[model samples]
Target: MAPPSTSKLEDDVSVAFRNPSHHSNCAAELDNKHVNDQDDYKPERDARVWLIFLALSVSAFLTPLELTSVSTALPTILNDLHGTDFVWIATAYTLASTAVLPMTGGLAEIFGRRPAMLASLSLFGLGSALCGAAQNVPWLIAARAVQGMGGGSMASLTNIIIADLIPLKDRGLISGVLALLWAVAAALGPVVGGALTARPGQWRWLFYLNVPIVGVAFVLVLILLNVRAPTGTFSEKMRRMDWIGNFLVVASSSACVIAITWGGVTYPWQSPRVLVPLILGLLGLVLFLFYEARFAREPIVPFSLVTNRTSFSGYLQTFICPFLTLGVIYYMPTYFQACKLASPVRSGIDLLGFCITLGPAGVLGGVSVSRLNGYRVQAWVGWTLLIIAMGLLSTINEDSSLAKTVAYPALVGVGGGIVYAVASFPVLAPLPVKESAHALAFFSFCRAFAGVWGVAIGGTILQNELSRRLPPSFAESFPGGVALAYATIPKVASLSEPARDAVRAAFAQSIAVIWRVMIAVAVLGLAVSLMMKAVPMHAQTDENWGLEKSRDGELEGREGTEEGSDEKRIEKESIEAVI
Candidate 1:
């Protein structure tokens, strides 16, 4: 394509800024009601905008709450279900969430954010209701999967909405506030679950609780949010969606989740049960990539975004942080319950050290990025704290004091808050205005996928260690030996003091292994962060500034050439097709 003359490019930008709504269609964005970089693009602080933000905040808090809420209540849920589907119960929702994420962008683009968000909330509420009514483990697992699909959409859209309304300069502060909701929810999920599971049938309340809360959010969104949608019939909208791509994404993700979950626990690493799904998943993912890049009319996740150096860095960091964070969130309770012999409620209380500090740090980090005008240095400090926190965690054992244990994980929570607050900006800030929503969808996909892997990794370690050690350790006085010991917590009356001590020792060692793995992961994350393009506080970067610059550079050589006219015509056609 021939590059536009400098004066002409300038003219377009000036006019576009002058009236984004009027000029948006000529270049690329049909639905960018407000361009992010223009002064007029700033989000309104009107009652309506804030009300919409309120609805978003409620769902933001609830997503993490639902995700982590099941951890502390697992033992009780397992016992009551009378089945060994504990891993499935835990992984199903996360897996569903992960699978749905790749399609969220396309779905939102076709349906509009308001409808997509409302549909996700409705699915989540329905899934929650079903889970509360479940009579068996399988039923509950299915419901959780359903719930997770909704959560994936909710998580993805909340940030998309922010990008939709708020300009880049002040987004960090608002993003920080949103991160606070996540921090609080993540912190409180297990506590709420533990408290709910205090009685015989109390676990059901965790799911039942979502009904009213989602209903409230649903009403808020219904009344407040009015997003722009394309003009199309129902069939046109459906046809425009990347349905084949969506199916492939779901299939590959499901297979990957299965392989990850069963790598060593359900089957040995070499067994077909593990290897087949693992290999199939890898191949399917490859096929999905090729299909999206070469064949799909509209890809659910744009391959171009992932290929960008800056965007890839953000997604990679997002994935690794959650993988490590959930590794701690899921397994720390095991340490408290088995080693310290704390009740579920008490163990959740012990976690307050980590939880209490996390939200403040996220809020601080988020606002600081805006005030300081950059993300690089804060990220460095955040990663350093995370690595330090992991190192401290490596020292914990069965005999560790409650205060020390609390302090170690508390450090991790703080670091997590700091790093994650500004993580998405790199991907978002450097993109074309219209592409930000797709980037946000990919970001959510990475985070949700990481949660599943985190749990799987932690569980694999704990289960492998317990399987290796429990039989010998418990042989002295415990008749049921390893199986019984691993199934029940140390506080159970059937286990004698010696047996309980042995079980606790084994779990503590396994948890130490988890911490070690996380240290390696955190170090890897640090290395990745170092290589990313640094956005300094003083850069004065625009949301879509680089895209225009890059496009012009690509077309520079074609300018004034004989082939220029044809190329320009093709480029314009491509832009219109996508829009």
Candidate 2:
């Protein structure tokens, strides 16, 4: 009923890392394999490979840039667009991104990586153009969904391509470099968004700016990215896709996000608007998993990916870390604006402490994993630090000093940076190289999906707290219960003394709840991460997806291998028998 255990040989190798005395042959084999890996495929030594990595780095930069920039500019966007619903603006991007992530591995397999990547770039560019031109709220939300689809696919593809090019053991420094780019983009995003929003109609430039950058990255990918395409007719390729699985995932994810976004904010939690979709979405997901496990000819998320304790822990940690990090990123600006009375530009500048620390720490973390050849310790250290940071953050009040404001988030940066850099190791370590695409797609999906909950839950807590904390008369003046936080920010500056102080304290206290929840989540992450064993990283890249060298330079013949034929035959026999 299931495919052969792909990780069996790797799991045997991993035992050597944990107990070398009893498995000396495994150790010797692993060491010799690494020696061969160094000589055979070192992308660092190839100029063209460097260019391709550069292209991926640039593409990777765009996703975080859009995410962070939108956060700083959101309050301003709501005012300019005359929109009451702030949740949809943020939720739409993440929802679309999460829904599209599960199928990207299959897309890369069916269509070559280069073509899939180029298509994603095109969608991103087009969405950016539409976002810049949008004059209303709904139109902008729709356009952001489009941009999200592209961004999500690109994010998965970059890692997928990197896995194709470099062995896992050698990917540390490379991962660090990409992490640095991410930190830079994240740090720059808020500042850029704030500067653009400082002037009337200037916010359009935020979206417009992405177009030219996308154009450059697209051209580079088209010219230089020459990875191997799968061999098959269109019909054959179509048959291999898990179409039903993809549709179920997309539809179910959308329904769930819509429910989460609307619950307690746009509608009462008890209302059918919230309950029906939530229930249906949960049921749909269960059905989807069942279909994938029992009936699909080629499953996108094989049960093997999650059934193992080590990989399951990896997925859980991946989901939780981003859940905490995004809550901080999205809500910290609100704290600056509402409690500290900082302007959009000032708030963005205030975040430099966090932005500056995250990048270098990530590089250090990745390098440590490479040098030490173990990811479990680094992850433990990271989660421990994050727990401490979140605890300190919860102690902030209205009268807290700027030093606390700046220093606390910087602590988060350090811990988050470390965890984020090496989070993929445990998931990939015990798995075969061929499973990288599926595993990484699910990895990216978990990360993106967590963001949806992070923002939604943080907003819900803040709104409910504000309702209780704000003066009764003042609360009544702003009609919509949960929707009033963003609207109340601009008005905070004009309030009378006692009321003003009350509102500030309310905001400070409400935001602290978000941090308190992060503390609990971080602790859980730390505990879950302990399930990860010191599995050895892979020393080989997927042979099927490796780069295709130019004929004039270096000709490498493809081995005649009937890959996945046995799995296909098994699936055919099982289907004929019926589930």
Candidate 3:
């Protein structure tokens, strides 16, 4: 049975933003009644809180830094370590990260967010240290997976902490800033990786560089940020966690990712390598959901959050939006290199337009949401722009100028910035403060999961189009003239003159075809964005609305009355739980 109705969930979460302190403070007090003994929390302008947020942002930036950096550095790393298992280098981290995300909330609940964050940071630092020192591809892959766990945790925890600290009214602005920082990090990652790989052994420095930064962030968090622990005996907290559910989800989702990633890339879609995992992963997913809904004491993704229109809608939107964005991100450089005949450096430079526009676009989108105190309009605007961007990109041929190509992809970036600007608001807004961590975990999971799907599906579409567009010519011209050649930028030198022209034409046409498919994906995302209902952001607090707004004396009196019973109940519960 569902624990809370959709309307009830909304009421439990939604606040009168105008007087957030009263609504949220009292609501939190009522719910916990025991956990938060430190009655004074940080105000909006607290230097300490903002400092903590900044520190968290650095961790957030670090996650994407590793993600984008590895792509450019992998070849160099491969050169030094030299293993056929090179493919697993990237996939390992992705699998570990995605598998670990569902556990983050429960970890936070048990360990407390501060301890969880510190643990994650420490683990990532250790992983980075190991990665820098690795002598073999397999060992490096293992380190990357360890790093990914920390990266995944940091990504989820940052969002959860942001929601914990910021009120509904101001979250958009902060979200925008974070998005901007991510954009900067993502854009810089390739450059940093490429620079490090300029020398044969320099690639190891990429991981090495992170250790010091992580150390600083760890010290800062340990010193400045403190979160209230949930009220429970350690055993009760352990019992409350859905350990079985976590295992099932990790197993199921990791299996599915392995299937999707290897399918049509490393293995044939029909190969047992692909099919068995696909089948098992699907079964596991169903089992995980069933356990969460029916048997788990505390579900990772609670039914209330899943069923609530706004929360579910946000989840859908997050999954699909990134699915589209990742496709573009994955393939755009290929388009520049193959069709436009640009050097890798030139290609990376061309991508700067996207990097630059998205940062401001994200911030602007956030500002719009914050000032308007409405997110639906922003959603419509963002998705519509993406749909239009993808559609425009489909028109590009080999003859299309760099200016046109640059401008076209920039639209997708702009749309990404806009859509992602308000990403967390809808998910967290309609859920209680308690569920914020779960919502953020789910949201972050969508982004991570989309990475696998985007690259695999986009590669499949491009390869299929190449096979369709140049059937006889495709087989004859290239050295290895099957779909796999097109999988990663197919070299055109194997073909002489007219055949080479045919190859280029095929490649360009194939990219256009992918762009058209992306348009459909964008359309799907836009369609879902329309389903998001507008929740009110502003509320009048003078009427003793939501959280109690008692006068100073009255507030003290109420606290005094509740203190004795609350303390007694807490003591009794703790003792009973321990016993």
- Looking at model 3, residue 130 earns an lDDT score of 93
Task: Compose the digit string of candidate 3's lDDT tens values, residues 176-267.
Answer: 88889888986887678767877778888889989998998898888766655556788877787888999998889888877876676567
Give the Cα error of residue 96 in candidate 3, in Å. Answer: 1.8
Which consecutive 10 residues in model 1 have the weakest lDDT in total?
Answer: 540-549
Backbone clashes per model, in order?
1, 0, 0
**Model 2 reaches what TM-score against the true structure?**
0.89
- Rank candidates by lDDT, best first: 2, 1, 3
**Model 1, 360-453: lDDT tens per residue?**
8888988987887777777788888999999999999999987889999999988898888989877776676567777888899889888888
**Candidate 2: worst 10 consecutive residues by lDDT?**
555-564
Cα lDDT tens digits, model 2, 78-157, are 88998867888898888888988998989898888998899989988998999999999999999999999999999999
- TM-score-wise, the better of 1 and 3 is 1
**Superposition error at 415 for model 1 (Å):** 0.7
lDDT values for all models: 0.77, 0.85, 0.72
How many steric overlaps does candidate 1 have?
A: 1
TM-score of 1: 0.85
**RMSD of candidate 2 to true structure, Å:** 8.3
